[model samples]
Target: MKVELVQLAGRDGDTAHNLARALEAIAACAADTDLVVFPETHLMGFPTRDTIAALAEPLDGPTLQAIAQAARAHDIAIAIGMAERDGEHYYNTTVLMTPQGIALRYRKTHLWASDKGIFTAGDRYATALWKGVRVGMLICFDIEFPESARALGQLGAELIIVTNGNMDPYGPTHRTAIMARAMENQAFAVMVNRVGTGDDGLVFAGGSAVVDPFGNLLCEAGREACRQVMVLDFDRLQAARNDYRYLDERRLTLPGERIEHADGRRELMIPQDSF
Candidate 1:
């Protein structure tokens, strides 16, 4: 699977226009690309909750339809983030559109500060399989929590795709975290972040990148332009996993599995009466 991380320059509160341009960018970079990952809130520019809410649209709506069409046209799977409006509530949803017109949606589980009042958090954890590759979806702030990435890794996800709209300039915490999660979980991690400045006097760092399971940076975008595509080798990733064999360490002797809260990290519960 060739995953392409596209660092998009999101338009300021212009969902429709940005979406149309998004298709063009996808078309230009879709060749031999199995998956195309875009930035968070690529459709609706990120900032105020009101602006995000106003730009939200229902599933199978115009924005998604355009995305599906582009996916089908390029024969590639595209993963993107949008402020989704389902009835009266909104979610920071990441939608994965396949070449066959199938869409798997994952709402962001972690809500950043000041965004909790705007978006609803998702309860269920789900990952989608595309072309024999187990892929997991996460948004900007969601990747900050180690639990989310570890959960996906334990669930047999080989690649963690993250869509982000974070713009904390002079800080590289998000970038550092992206590489760390990949290293810790032994999974390929790719993050696509929005570039340029938004309405809130916030300037993005624009360090969109992909890291291997060994935590080595594969490809990264520069500061100025937030648009580039790099191909990732699945064969190399599979070789790495085979050599490490970390997934073989998980073994459950009981029928039912349990999760336990311990200290600050969540841990798998030990089987009862096993002494």
Candidate 2:
């Protein structure tokens, strides 16, 4: 599958401008690409509490409708992030729109920084089949937790897409974490992060990239507004899985006893006889 990652700088509190930028990027995507992914909150830059509430829109809002129209016109699947409004509550959501229409909507499960107070956490993880590939969806901080990627891998997701708004001083860390997730899960991982600074003065590091199951970086973008297209090799993915068998050999339960730590002290809890 050929996927395009759009790394762009979003305008703070300007949904209209940001939406236009996103559409322009989508339109500029290479032909024959199966999917295109944009950074988190692509509709509007990550904002303050008041700005978030003000800019949040319903699922059927105009921003998404416009994106869906573009997806249909381009005949490609597009995944982009936005602030979703559902009555009084708002969520950091990623909407995956296919050529037909909206295919999947995933809310950010793990809130980061100010998001904890501005948005409600999502309750479920979602996956969809696109172009014969089992694709899993996750937002920014969700990929930081190993369990998020592992859960999707267990659910038979061969490709995991992370829509992020990660910023400076921690961009390298997030990039390493993404590669680790791909290696451990034996799945292709793609992360699309934004660039430039936000209203809060947070400088986003746009190191958007695609990694193979073997942790090889297929392509990576620097801290600039750009787009990258790469082909995912199913053969390489299968070869990596066959060579490591990490997922197949994983043991969900620890044998005998489990370790515990608290207040700098460690203890072992014995398992029941049923074990």
Candidate 3:
């Protein structure tokens, strides 16, 4: 799988500008790229109480419709975050969008500072099949918790995607957390963070990166606006999982089974033992 990480700053509450940049990035992605990811709230930016009502949009709103259109136009899967307005409540959400449509959606489960009163937390983690790979998403502060990535792992995620908005003094924190999350789950991890300063004067950290299953950093961005791409080999996944499997050892001996469908589909099937 080939993925591109977009590290750039977004004007807070400016959907028009951000969406334009996002669409442009999607359109410019390499022809062979399978996915393109952006930072947290890349669409709506950081919505304050005063602007939340105007900036937040429902999943089916024009913003997503535009993004879906971009995904279709580019023939690439796009992973990004936004301020999702769901009826009377709002969520910090991320989604995986394929050419067909939305492949996966995950609301931020653990709200960070300022997110507490503005957004409702998501209760569960989920993954979806994207080009034969099981993909899951996390937001800015979500990767800090081990359980966040673990939940996706249990749901059969082989690739973990994170849309981050981490700022000054905390860049190193997520830098370490992303690698830890992938290593612990024995899955590939990718994180895209925002750069430059925000409306509130908070400087976003732009250390976007990609980590392999064995916790090695394949590529990492500096604290600047940039676009980076990496090719992931599925063979590396098997090489890492061929030994002691973390998914099986972390829980009951359900005897995990890996399936490779002739058409290129791959899956890790483990019987559920409800925790």
- Clash count per candidate: 0, 0, 0
lDDT of each: 0.76, 0.83, 0.87
State, as a TM-score between 0 and 1, how close model 3 is to the true structure: 0.91
Sort by TM-score, best first: what order?
A: 3, 2, 1
Report the alpha-carbon TM-score of model 1 versus the true structure.
0.85
Q: Superposing all C-alpha atoms, what RMSD in Å does each candidate have to the true structure?
A: 6.5, 8.4, 4.5
The candidate that wins on lDDT is 3
Q: Model 2 scores what on Cα lDDT? A: 0.83
| Residue pairs with clashing backbones, model 3 | none
The order by descending lDDT is 3, 2, 1
Our model 1 lands, by Cα RMSD against the true structure, at: 6.5
Tens digit per residue, CA lDDT, model 1, 8-112: 677767887789878887888757888888888787766376576567888778888889988888899999888888988888888888877754677887888
- Greater TM-score among 2 and 3 belongs to 3
lDDT of 3 by residue, 1-275 (tens): 99999998888999999999999898889999999999999999999988998999998999999999999888999999999999999999998888888787888878898897888887557678888888888898999998778877876789999999999999999999999999988999999999999988999889999999998999999999999999988788899899877988885432345554553333433334422
In angstroms, how far off is 42's CA in candidate 3? 0.3
